[model samples]
Target: MTHSPQLWQPLQYGTAEWQRVYFRLRNAIEGMNGFGKDPLYECLESGGTHRIRGIAAQAVLVAFQLAHANKRKLATWAGSIAVDGNRPHRRATRRRKTKPLGSWNHEGYLTEPSE
Candidate 1:
């Protein structure tokens, strides 16, 4: 067994397919976390707004919050894909500056998904 398993994985980890798949999945997760923590959208931070007590109450609150967040995300996505006349036009994606890290991005991918 290797002393550090992370450094030993040298298979198909550096391929473009790997980067695209990993980044798409990772962006979804980070996007949700950022959306939930956003001040204008949600108040998920500690000592921010709510003062509810107990685990059950907190869980319920969070569940409802996430549900609302989902609805908002869906609405925003729909608006982005809104059609004009008879044609269905997709929203243009913004181009990002080149990052020093791999295609997965440095800030978003806190850790490797898997090798």
Candidate 2:
């Protein structure tokens, strides 16, 4: 790792905490992206949905769509929390356990057996 150029935007690169933080953020981003692309929801992939001529218009429409998505997401979150305030906490899933490798020791090999 080069020390001269500090890792900005994300300070931690390969550390354990960095991974945990980034993975959580990635999950949220992917969830929102999926929500935006879904046909029943935002239909962001379809140009006909916006039907706008200029970049400014399209940007405004997209901004509104994102706001709508955020509203829907917030409502769903609030409803879930209201319904089951005492919801059971999920346990951390166990990592796949691999068989421990057997220790091997090298010994001198005789080319020919002693008479």
Candidate 3:
């Protein structure tokens, strides 16, 4: 079957699906230690607590709604941002050079070291 290559599809939820998914997500967050009891209570009453909780809860809600509307055939996708080895490396230690040190003359010109 062919599917639309769009991400703006509408999401919906019905029955106890929202409650189930919400609790599952809540449990996962609680397990992570990032969501304390206070935040959980706050989320139960206001959809979210802290900034992270709010953002995660919003994403979970959207996913739950999509899953519910699409049922078993629904396709849900998630991805994480990653750095692909593009960062520059910083030296952890300074290396000592065995070569004789060069000298800078009074005029600021570098000169070969005298034997």
> What TM-score would each prediction reach against the true structure?
0.53, 0.60, 0.19
- Order the numbered candidates by TM-score, best leading: 2, 1, 3
Indicate the worst ten consecutive residues by lDDT in candidate 3. Answer: 72-81
Candidate 1 on 2-105: residue-level lDDT in tens? 45765665446869888888899899999898888778776676455567998898888888888888888888787766476544445688988775555475
- State the lDDT of candidate 2 residue by residue for 9-102, as single tens digits: 4546869988889999999899899988889988988887998889999999999999998898877676555344576434477999854343
Runs in model 2 with CA error above 4 Å? Answer: 1-10, 83-115
TM-score of 3: 0.19
Q: Regarding lDDT, does 1 or 2 come out ahead?
A: 2
Better of 2 and 3 by TM-score: 2
Model 1, position 34: C-alpha lDDT score:
84
Q: Model 3: C-alpha RMSD to truth?
A: 19.8
Model 1 ranges with Cα > 4 A deviation: 1-20, 84-115
Predictions in order: lDDT: 0.74, 0.77, 0.48
User: Model 3, residue 33: displacement in angstroms?
Assistant: 1.3
Best by TM-score: 2
Regions of model 3 farther than 4 Å from truth: 1-14, 34-115
Candidate 3, residues 1-115, lDDT tens digits: the string is 6657663333335437667787888897665333222342223234333234467777776555444434422221211222474544333668876543446667867787579
